[model samples]
Target: MENLPKSIQVIFDKNPKLSELITNPRLISNSPFIFALSQKLNYSAKGNEDEYFYRIVFKEGSSRELMTINSGELRGLPTTTCIEKGKISDVAGLERVELDNESNLMPVLLGISLYSSIQNSLSYISNLCVDIRNHQILEGQARFERISETIVDIFNSIPDLALDKSLRDAYLSRIVKNNDDCYELYVSQREQLRHSLKGNNPDYNSKYYYENELYLFKDKLLTHPVFSVFERLVAGRICEIILSGNYSKSNIQRHKDFISKAESDINDIMASRISDLDRRISYYKRDIEMDRNLTRDGIEYHNTQIEKIELGISSIKKQIFNLLGVKLSSFDLLSQLMSKDEIDVFLIGGNLIVNDMQLTSDEML
Candidate 1:
């Protein structure tokens, strides 16, 4: 459209992609806006198979003003309004005549601009995908740190107790009378210890046999009801001591309680982090789909990227389990991370490898 602004003409020629398209009448005519604009203007067209070119001249006193279309569906198109109003009558044309839009060049410019925007949007998606995916691994590792520390603290806090000689002897006597298997194992073990200790020249001065037998007695005590009851009493005492703010007070029950609480907290933390990654991934997918240039290959590549993140999520969960001995069947990382309310896995780093083979859906109790 010759009635269109001269600056708009510059936009078409400056963009290589748009310039190439406008020179191809067969391609440009396919768009309805371009076809309509071409009919409205008086233009001479020329071009070969490789390119089409056109020039348009407005008749003196033409009443209509050329307008540019702005539609979201055609995100690439630049608006003709962007050009200065005073420059609309400036001359624009190609020396070579071909099927061209002339004033209708606005559509071609708009299409190219849309394409550029799409590329930029796609690029954003690609970059964001990398971070969102990596975040999955990072978040899990953070939770792992907390849970593992709690576990180590619990294990280290267990108190060591000394058994009295008389109490030990009494517990052993009951175990020997009641549990035949335990009694047999203890006796067998003591005999083996004696056989080794008394070899050739036995050091008689060392009460090594009785000492070893005493050690065996402790093992036997584990099967005695009295000793088990005593162990519970010790645990309760330790818990009380710890709650009283005594540093030296250590209890197995306290440790167990702490571990249980830590485990629950860790589970909640992991669920929230995984959910965060999943939600972002869903958004990424939606934005990616919005790009008109999206290809099957592009989608497949991104899906593979997502799979890598999912595998990473699984690996991190396994690490947490290994560190804390807490495995959750609900944390089945193999399930699709993108599924609503399901695991949304994300990973960072291109060189990440899932080295552990222990990732399975089985509940590790």
Candidate 2:
């Protein structure tokens, strides 16, 4: 659970099967559980606050005990306690007395637990989005457009949970500063492709050359450090927003154009699919009538083709259902953007005296 992102943990805690799939890179899709978890975060965050608590376990013989306090009415209550002994694994050139006096271990472990959860959450969301766009069944730019729109919408719905502007900008600024060369190359390749496309007799070789270069550019974009940094930033922002309830209009609007483009592209795909289905339906019906007395094999082949057409229609319907809801501006469509409702934030007081910070629902947003 410590290794998994909070978003993934949310799903894992509810459905154990999903936990198995977490480390299995081959099976991560926008599965029903993922979608459901996403919805819960989006909608639940809007109403109630999420409760936060920290737990720590210490090793003792073959088992572990919850750390606890020793005084007052809550004397028996679990508390942050000290480690009394070290394992055989800690015997490397270390004095026995030194092992028990490792006072810095607690904060080091706490910091790891905190940042690891955050970084993992960002990786989970970004990887999921990329995987969805790269599904084998999709073969064009429409998938990118659709997923881009989905990302924008999801980010927009979450309350602005970004930290101070300087911190947020620091992550974002890295994108431009670190990737100037790649950005220039990408722009040059795009311009080259545009020029090639506008030519009267652009050779197949030239077209392929430009296309391949553009594909490489995209690969570079995905692998770039800045891309991962931005994803972590977005994930952290969303987590904070859901927990805090603060809304950042600027953050929400960052990818508005991308969303608009995706919506347009998806709409175009819907229209094209509908048109193709109508044409194929008419053609197949006429062919069946004209060959009314054909051999059994010929008739079977026609029937098979018709069945495939029917399947295509069914697939488009499902895609439409997933990508765009029954009506525009409906909450159901917001499911596409999801990935929460709320709880609370806390720092359990003990040896660690960080008091629980009180915040209202609005302040959280």
Best by lDDT: 2
Candidate 2 structure quality by residue, lDDT tens digits, 240-331: 33323223444334333323343343445345435545565566668778966777787787677668657656765664543333222221
The sequence of per-residue lDDT tens digits that candidate 1 reaches over residues 1-365 is: 24224544455456667544443111111233233333334324433244343434345454234435556686654332322353454332223333333453433333222222222212222232223322222223343233223222321222110001232234334332323332233334334333433343322244353334333323331122222112222222222222222222133344445444534543444444444445545644775778778788877865765565466556656654533342211122112111213211111111111111222244222
RMSD (Å) per prediction: 36.2, 17.1
TM-score of each model, paired residue for residue:
0.23, 0.32
Q: Which candidate is the best by TM-score?
A: 2
RMSD of 2: 17.1
